[model samples]
Target: MVIDLQNVSFKYENVNVIQEITAHFNPGELVSLVGPNGAGKTTLLKLISGTLKPSSGKIYIYDQQSHNLTNKKRAVWISMVPQNPKLPDEISIPDFVMLGRNPHLGLLQWESKEDFNIARKSMSLTEIDYLSRRKLGEISGGERQRAMLALAITQQSPIMLLDEPTSNLDIYHQIKVMKLIKKIHTLKSGFGVTILAIHDLNIAAQFSDRILLFSNGSIAADGMPKEVLTKNNIDSIYGSEVTIITHPEHGTPVILS
Candidate 1:
């Protein structure tokens, strides 16, 4: 799948949340959107996912205009995992995952065997199968996040757009979830990801194949992690004191601020 944005701008009231921003995302890549608070990272994801439209310019997903897609088909092409997953108290993880099959079901159609199989597979892939029978509200924060990921995976979209996916998890599960995402990208040749509004510079640098740093409602830097996460760029955009160093094992990046 491909995502292309050209002169995209969005506004809420008189405030311009995003301004004439242009970007492209390709398949088999994990891209991170990072910036200060209210820098329009999440808003950009919202625009790409069709939750918000550009007030000016255009956004195309795989050459199709976002808003023009039918509702059911939209969920099938690009799935989203929001920061706060609001699962009902009575919804079990298994059944919660079944909701992802909505695009494939008719108005009154029951979930079929294939839907069950896909949901189970997604649960296992997210390492949350053990939480299947548990109520979503009854699970721990990290487990619930994984369950939500399971739901997204069950949607079987080519592109996954996540907004602060690891925000609520502790350090250990944060790494676990990042690794699960990496595994999925590796295992599925055509699958790709875009993460929005993440604050942890080191984690974003470590995981994303590319990084788009936002500043004042526009892209400040866009390139590989090594290029976009440089000390100069970090200082310029974030106004922070940061030292960029290599990771001990992977030699990707390790940031000190």
Candidate 2:
């Protein structure tokens, strides 16, 4: 397992956001966390990214206790693209993307040519190289989203976590970004693992190797998309009527409402 959570739970303002959850994520898997609003999906991502410590239980990354790892060390292992991160508006897009290299740089060290090459490659892969010179504040929401993804890619970590990466994108851009992510996961001989908290059920079903359905601070279902995205599971957890079908080309589950 690349990440192991042992009875992990988190509370916010006396409210249990993530309750006694035990889960394990393996390498080379593209896993999606899906559920209705307030289901603690984002909170779970934060816990794994080490941004929010678990109020109870433990999280192990590659068999090392998560809490014992320093912030820099954790960054070297995991990279995250948060739902709504606070970014500096005045920084150029390339500059922001290069910041991802900080975790690997020595203290007071300037970015080297190798770091620049990595950052450039990331921007190209994310399709944001055209906006290199533009300030972050000057970009559109979709553009900013891609820029954030580029930054995370530049980190070159084994594990990547994204929250709503396709939120602001149109259909074309949505598919494009997802395909890019899938391509990246397959690189390095498929050793990378990606976990995303996404609201789009169809997209999740199409791209995810496994689906984790969250409900009321717990996992309602966990399995391959075809197994976990059945009509019964959707009706019970989402409380909505949805039709499940198989994609003609990909043979993956497709959720239609």
Candidate 3:
């Protein structure tokens, strides 16, 4: 397993936000966490990324317990694109993306040619290369989201966690970014495990190798998209009526309002 959570539970202000989530994310898998608002999906991602320690139980990244690892060591194993990242307005896009290389560099060392090359390639892969010289303050929200994703890609970690990656993106960029993420997961030398907290069920059903449905701070369902994304499951968890249909091309479940 690339990422493992063993009976993990977390509390904020003495209230449980994540309740005993025991799951393993396998290599080369793209897993989507789906649920309604306040389902703890984002909180779970934070726990896995070691940004938030669990109140109880364990989180392991490639056999090393997250709580025991130093912040730098943890960064070497996981790279995360947060839902609402705080960008430095004065920093140029390329410079911002290059910060991802900090984890691999020695304390006194600067970004090497290889590091810059990796950053450039990540920008290209994310189609943000054209904005390389632009300051973060000049970019649109959607563009900024892509830039953040580019930075995460440049980190070159084995496990990638994204919170609402498609948020703020229009339909075109949403599909584009999702496709790029799918391709990145398929890359043999790149990320081994990709986990995303997403709200768009259709996109999740189409791209995810597996889907985890979260509800009330727990995993309501966990399985392949076809197995977990049924009409009954959606209705039960979301408390809303949605029709489930098959995609014409891929035959995956499509949630229709």
lDDT, candidate 3, 146-194, per-residue tens: 8987898889888889999999889998998898888887874534889
Q: What CA RMSD would candidate 1 show?
A: 1.3
Better of 1 and 2 by lDDT: 2
Candidate 2 has a TM-score of 0.97
Give each model's whole-structure lDDT.
0.85, 0.93, 0.90
TM per prediction: 0.96, 0.97, 0.97
Query: 1 or 2: which has the higher TM-score?
Result: 2
What is the per-residue lDDT of model 2 for residues 164-214, given as tens digits with 9 covering 90 to 100?
889878998889878877888887457888999999999999999999999
Worst 10 residues of 1 by lDDT: 188-197
TM-score of structure candidate 3: 0.97
Report residue 80 deviation for candidate 1 (angstroms).
Answer: 0.3
Clashes of each: 0, 0, 0
